[model samples]
Target: MLKSDKLERLELYKDRNTQVFLNKFLSEEISELEPVYDPKVGYHYPIVEAIVGSVQDAEAFLNRLYNAGILERRLYDKIIYCPKCGSANVSVRYCCAYCKSFDIQRSALIEHVKCGYMDVEENYKKGNKLVCPKCHEELKKPDVDYRRAGTWCTCKDCKKSFDIPVVAHFCRDCHTAFTFEDAVIKDVYAYTLREDAKEEAARGWVIIAPIRDFLLENGFEVESPAFLKGKSGANHMFDIVAYEGK
Candidate 1:
């Protein structure tokens, strides 16, 4: 742990003027900690911990890094194993749980398409599935062979253009089946903030948009941070400037 070094550094910052030093240290260290963001934090805990200072500081730093565009975060599919079998073997049936059959499917052209019934004219393409309703089946998807068919299907389940073959994963849990892409994933560029990650401390946690809105809502003239020559001659921008008020 870098506790000793940090505490020693803290000692140097004991004087009232230490705030400036702290700012410098934070900015400098962030750049050095550049390896923590990718492929999950499971790999480099030491480096992340040292750069982050403390757990709380690490979290705050991560958030600031996100805003600065040094790193990005996005949602992904909630992949889990079937509790009953503990086997990775799985498929969305009807729109529910991973079933062992293929009596249901969803066509992804318009929107929802799981129900076997309903004849809607769809100029759909191949490889689309929707969640099933009745048995709570997860929509079935097409394989390479199915995509080659170039068939368009309008599903009555979701009223979307998705093509299905048979029963997909049926949710034995909630009985609600559907197709989805895990959310957006955060993408961070190493070079984006590498040089100045440490310098970002002055910007603080609050994002510019919200802070700007706060100023507007409360009726204050606000503008960009005044640029000043930092300790190392780095030109810097403050997070904000607002009129003093109640």
Candidate 2:
């Protein structure tokens, strides 16, 4: 059961924006509000953005509702961003382990079973045919004369060979290069309306109907679920708006 005083204090369903936002869930338009990752804006809720007009506003509104127990949030993802400018527009780079140069080439390593010779595939190339560098034997087919053992990499700048390369990140927004240690990690969340709140919202008008009856019996013209413009130029909704001889 939901407390009427708490709902009134938080201005929950009475607000027009709150009603519209929750109606999407009541009508089954969306099951959950998932956070979409945008390079320029980081994690955002597109569905909420369409209603609230901006990512920042959507974030604030959703978090407020979540804190008030109207919505539930779950961790969706953990994304890495640029610590310098705090942007999620980051790309990965593979560099040579020895010299940290991006100029590198990868090749498959071939092994000749007969002579037990293993080397890069380039060394086995001979006039459109595979010839073992150690035994000088013409390789016919795979698993018979030779087989692919693994892969190897060579750095063109430092002339160094290695099995793995170093991983690094570059920010597209700020043009900054950094490793995982220097990057910022943020947790993204997805939101959904709470089941109890959904039930309460369905019968919200019933709970506030006594106020409407009281105003009508007092000889005042009343409007239930009325919208009025505020001083800030924002429209607000009320459960009952009573007018005196208007």
RMSD of 1: 18.1
Number of clashes recorded per candidate: 53, 0
TM-score: which candidate is best?
A: 2
Count residue pairs with overlapping backbones in model 1. Answer: 53
- Model 1 off-target regions past 4 Å? 1-59, 68-162, 165-246
Q: Write the per-residue lDDT of candidate 1 for residues 1-246, one digit (tens) a residue.
A: 232233233232232333332343445653323334222221122444564566456555555444434334443233433334333233454431233233334333322244443232233323364333333444355441122234344444444444444443433444433333321223332222333323332333325546766887897876544355699999665546676555
* lDDT computed for candidate 2: 0.82
What lDDT does candidate 2 reach at residue 39? 77
Candidate number with greatest lDDT:
2
